[model samples]
Target: MSVRTATESDLEAWVALRLLLWPDTSPDTHRAEAAAVLAAPEATAFLEKAEDGSMRAFAEAALRHDHVNGCETSPVAFLEGIFVRAEDRGRGHGARLLAAVRDWARGRGCAELASDAHLSNVGSRAFHAALGFDETEHVVFFRMPL
Candidate 1:
């Protein structure tokens, strides 16, 4: 498996995997987001690809300068999304992808990496814990139409 920062050549495949994480979003929307990620100095997408040129997993991340839960530094390396095909799970592809994201963040002088999973997603929570992330804080959001 080869892990590398995504390029325009990998855009379509990367977006396909990303949609698995955000199934409701249109391909156009993901395309725009992908463009921004590739353009931004603070954001990047890392892809793990099989020898056949198929991507097995990918991770998107951005440098969040704002205060993120459990981070004590500015420009926290925030994990925006990650997805591995279910068939590809438990083979260390996710960990390798995450390590790529971590190296990207560390290269930019970040002190910590931060991420969040939906409150009800036990599998996601467990995945994070297995990756050595500690439970930090949780909150339920409230919204009111103005």
Candidate 2:
């Protein structure tokens, strides 16, 4: 029932949730990425812990100075990821975490906050909508080896 900044001690639980959200990434890669993210001054991660001292949910966000999809401002606050265990859904944890991140973004002088979900993830889209984010555009990305 408390929200706090994520720490290295929470890495295992954090990466477990990350794996659920992004199954394609290898555990080692996720560990490295999470470490880099946590070390960045422009990025922040938040964790919600239950009464028993275990993590309930987590959220990661960053200030994107580069062009961000659906953003009209430079240095927009972007929600990189969020997840609440299935058992914890519908308890307002998501909303509370998002509000804290939104405030963090504002404190950094960002004018807007942005996030996106996979096109086929209807539930995530609905969740974002319920949290007040608008559906701006649809895009499919592609990459080719050099």
Candidate 3:
């Protein structure tokens, strides 16, 4: 499996995989968001393709100049999303995609990479830990509508 940076041509496939990861969001929204990320200089996405050229996994990241929850520096790389097809898990595709993201961040002068998973997502937590991420803190958000 070869991992590479995603380009405009990969939009449709990227949105498809994004839906699998965030099914609650609409496809139109995913398309718009994917397009924006593709056009943003501070953000990037990496994709892994199979021998047949089908997309097997994808990861999106961005350089966050603001404070990142657990990081101690400005301009940290934030992993916005990563998804591997259920059948493709455990094949190291995710790791390879992350490696690419790491390189991209380092190229942009980012010192650290930060990411978050939902509190109840045990598998996601384990995935982060397995990849050498240390748990920093847990946070709960509150919202009030006017």
**Best lDDT goes to which candidate?**
3
- Across residues 98-133, which tens digit of lDDT does each residue of candidate 1 receive? 999999999999989999999899988988999988
**Quick one: ranking by TM-score, best first?**
3, 1, 2
Candidate 2 wrong stretches, greater than 4 Å: 143-146
TM-scores for all predictions: 0.97, 0.94, 0.97
Deviation (Å) of 126 in candidate 2: 0.4
- Give model 1's TM-score versus the native structure: 0.97
Residue ranges of candidate 3 with Cα displaced over 4 Å: none
lDDT of the candidates, in the order given: 0.91, 0.92, 0.93
Worst 10 residues of 2 by lDDT: 13-22
lDDT of 2 at 14: 87
Q: Single out the weakest 10-residue window by summed lDDT for candidate 1.
A: 47-56
Better of 1 and 3 by TM-score: 3
- Find the candidate with the highest TM-score and give its number: 3
Off by over 4 Å in 1: none
